[model samples]
Target: MGIFDVRKIDCHAHVLDPLRFPYAQGAAYRPSGQEIGTTDQFVEVLQCYGTEHVLLVQPNSGYGPDNSCMLDAIRRYPGIFKGVAIASLDADLSHLRDLRDQGIVGIALNPTFYGNDFYADSPALMEKLAELDMFVQIQVQHDQLLMFKPWIERIAVRVLIDHCGRPTPEQGLAQPGFSALLDLAETGRVHVKLSGYAKFAKTPYPFRDTLPFVRALVEAFGLDHCMWASDWPYLRAADRQDYGPLLKLLDTLFPDPADRDILLWQTPKRLFGFGA
Candidate 1:
């Protein structure tokens, strides 16, 4: 572990391996040719950045609800990794209990990509998540934040917002989507990850355009309500990016050592209930 030896945990990360798992049949987008990310590969990313633990978020590429790869990582390294399952609103809930037991902390929901009619609050989906004691990880458009608000309040489990809510910089701090996210954070039950900035950037390189929006999230949610993710393999990213530069950008975003510690590790530990 490099400078990240300070008890850091990567709140959000993805494992993309099509050869081994095979992309979701006829999926919207598939990585051209990526190898399976085994436990060792994940560990290398963490160690290279000094991240001691990580929360594995299910990618939209493999929408099959087959979380075998994510589960394998957790099982192989019980203490260092945790998983978030990408669940289909159409699937059976019984399968969730075993995933929960296998260290799956939540369900990754992507309504926009999958074109689902059930908004976050759909009574049917809520019932399923509640049954297994899992949280809901949502990837909603910056405008859809309000749609999930009711569900967040009604669901017994915590709700995590993905990729800064994919906010547009023009929306600034007052964007209804970002505003709703702040409101959710105030409730203390919602968490947001400052991952996927690449998706929100307008131009190239640093995606510096999203700085104000990112800062607003950190300020509104505070360190405890926020977490960091590498969004590995740079999938669905608007621009080509490397993981090393991304980590450096994060260091710049949270310059203070304490804030960095919380964003990188401590808050994630508390959020996912992961051990140091």
Candidate 2:
């Protein structure tokens, strides 16, 4: 089969069903009243884009630490879905173990929401996650990378930094935080997701402006540590973003078939424990 023909995995996406799982009162943001990202719709989108597997990240808009929606989706669609949940640093081990038992492979920490010292404040929790062999999925502001570096270095668990460390195109590759991010990848424990290009891109679709950052990251981390994802339901940009084009970016960025396979399938399969 051709490389692009092989079904791929989307390492990041969220399925929100407000009717059944209402948004938390203090949610950071809410979906349009009329539109909800249901699992079935998300699955349809994945199928349309040749994605066979997905890692559902708990939406901060879902408010509190209730991961019922994401966990339920995993239970209902075993093999097709895996998840990363948001839990407080002080959460109990039993609760975390339960999440692991339910096919949650990682814990998500958003420093943008939880503050810069989230990792530092949760050393015990980080150790527990390491003990469980679960990875930490982190989303932090671009400048926070250096601050997070020491904690990431000391922690034994695997870490996947979201949104290419959320760097802006204007910042350039030499920006201290992004440089630190690239340096972290050398540790062999850091992985970066090639998602959220639109968030930091200075220009419109095709997002060619951000290609240099993607290329630099790939060069730094290599295919084994790099994975591609479509931040589906693209939130505010939903009307503007589509899955096919996003998936095709890898093909455009990585001309070699083997490199495409690693970014689209192999790396994620290994990192997230997806079945062959």
Candidate 3:
């Protein structure tokens, strides 16, 4: 069967345009490598794989609150892209309502990329996000769960844990990150992407080392709230990876078509509010 028939939705992807959205001048940001950080490049790759839609996540490389490139992409190709913008705790989200109306549905909380202080809650930030009904996507190391749990609980918005909480594959299934993930699942207040395993794996291609941890996440969150991603451009290793192989790997993770459908299609559709 073709990858298009895979019924896929790439839950984590980024567009890097230093010209339009310059690198953050602040110490909190880092420059994305020259390769694997283009909106058009990502679109071409996604279309090649028959991804029905994609959630354009904000990468830490372009850490500033500005989302011009991301928003422009969605505006240019509305049918193919949905967006998740990232903002710091100090950001003024007053304009989010208009952005939300324009298909910007989520904001990322990147404590690991910025600093642990970014996860600290601001009543105004929470109030603005709640008003817009946006999802707050958190990218935190597994051990740092306690740092953001209280804020997560206080927010009325939907929560998405980036990259299975960026758990280390070597941690196996019993690490604090995984445990925190399970506990969060018990509350039914969060969703985790089955993406970015490449980032956490210790070995080379064929990152089978992550199988046990990936399996445990599936068991804990089930098929409904779990989704797949390519982490495309593959960031640091963009040259070594592409969307096709990532989809192939995801198929191995889910196996059964019904479960695969949820991971690849259904769950993201629900979580990201993709239109049928």
Name the candidate that leads on TM-score: 2
The Cα RMSD in angstroms, rounded to one decimal, for candidate 3 relative to the true structure is 2.4
Which ranges in model 1 have alpha carbons more than 4 Å from their true place? 1-5, 34-39, 90-93, 116-121, 127-132
Tens-digit per-residue lDDT, 111-193, candidate 3: 67657765555455766777667877877775776666666666666778888787776666778757777777766768888
Q: Where in model 3 is the C-alpha error above 4 Å? A: 26-34, 91-93, 122-124
Per-residue lDDT for 74-181 in model 1, tens only? Answer: 888998889888766655677677678889988888866754465534556656776766778888776876777777777676778888898777767788877888
- The TM-score, computed over Cα atoms with residue i paired to residue i, of candidate 1 is 0.89
lDDT of 1 at 111: 67
Residue-level error in angstroms, candidate 2, position 86 = 0.6
Model 2 scores a C-alpha lDDT of: 0.83
Misplaced by over 4 Å in model 2 are 1-4, 33-35, 117-120
Candidate lDDT (C-alpha), each:
0.75, 0.83, 0.75
Best-to-worst order by TM-score is 2, 3, 1
Evaluation by lDDT, superior candidate among 2 and 3: 2
TM-score (all chains, Cα) for each model: 0.89, 0.94, 0.89
